[model samples]
Target: MKKILIAHDGSKSSDKALRKAFELAGKFGSSVTVISVIPELYLTELMDIDRARILETLTGETTRTMEKIKASVKDVRTVRTMIRQGNPASEILDAAKKMKADLIITGSQGRHGAEKFLLGSVSSKLVDYAECSVLVVK
Candidate 1:
């Protein structure tokens, strides 16, 4: 694969996916783009006025997490980091298409039944919408 996109959320599942991406990249010498999505919605009781501050906090956290991943990976291959504000699934799919990715890797919490339906799993949505091959790591 020329380009591989991985959705990362700084979780163990995502860490597994990153390792898988590293393995594939090593095999094919593919460049990897790591994406972290920050949802824009606040809690029902949260004030809109504080949205900017909250978003700033979230962005900083995400950036730090990506940086940690980069450091741990240790120049394994070409890596690009992205932090986006929006629905995770849609943004990931859009990025994959825009980047012309041949493969996508993402983490799954492995939800079930009502919880999966109500929450709309990002990994599930990505598999449904992505044009390229999607690997959902458990």
Candidate 2:
């Protein structure tokens, strides 16, 4: 693939997914776009919220996560990072479309059966809506 989009949520599963993307990107000479979606509820729910502080925390965490991904990849030059605020699934798909990505890599929480039926997994919805290929890392 030429362009790859990886969605990371600062979770262990996501870290594995990021590492997998690094491996794939290296093999294919693909440019990797790493995205972290910070749920936007905090922005609206908190009264007199410090936007700068919230963004600082978000970007700082995202940067640290990106660093970990970079460390795992031998060639870091092809990797790019982005932090956004919204629903994770929609943001990921939107970012992929905007980047014209050939594939999307994401981590799964491994929820299934009754739990998945009640909670509704993001990966399942993404698989249905995404225009490009999606890889779910368990």
Tens-digit per-residue lDDT, 94-130, candidate 2: 9989999999988775313245234236677778899
Q: lDDT by residue for model 1 over 28-55, one digit each (tens)?
A: 9899999999986758777877877898
Error of 1 at 137 (Å): 1.4
Query: TM-scores of all models?
Result: 0.87, 0.80
How many residue pairs clash (N, CA or C atoms closer than 3 angstroms) in each of the candidate models, in the order given? 0, 0
Query: Which parts of model 2 have CA positions greater than 4 angstroms off?
Result: 42-45, 50-55, 110-120
Q: Candidate 2 — which pairs collide?
A: none
Best by lDDT: 1
Residue 68 CA error for candidate 1 (Å)?
A: 1.1
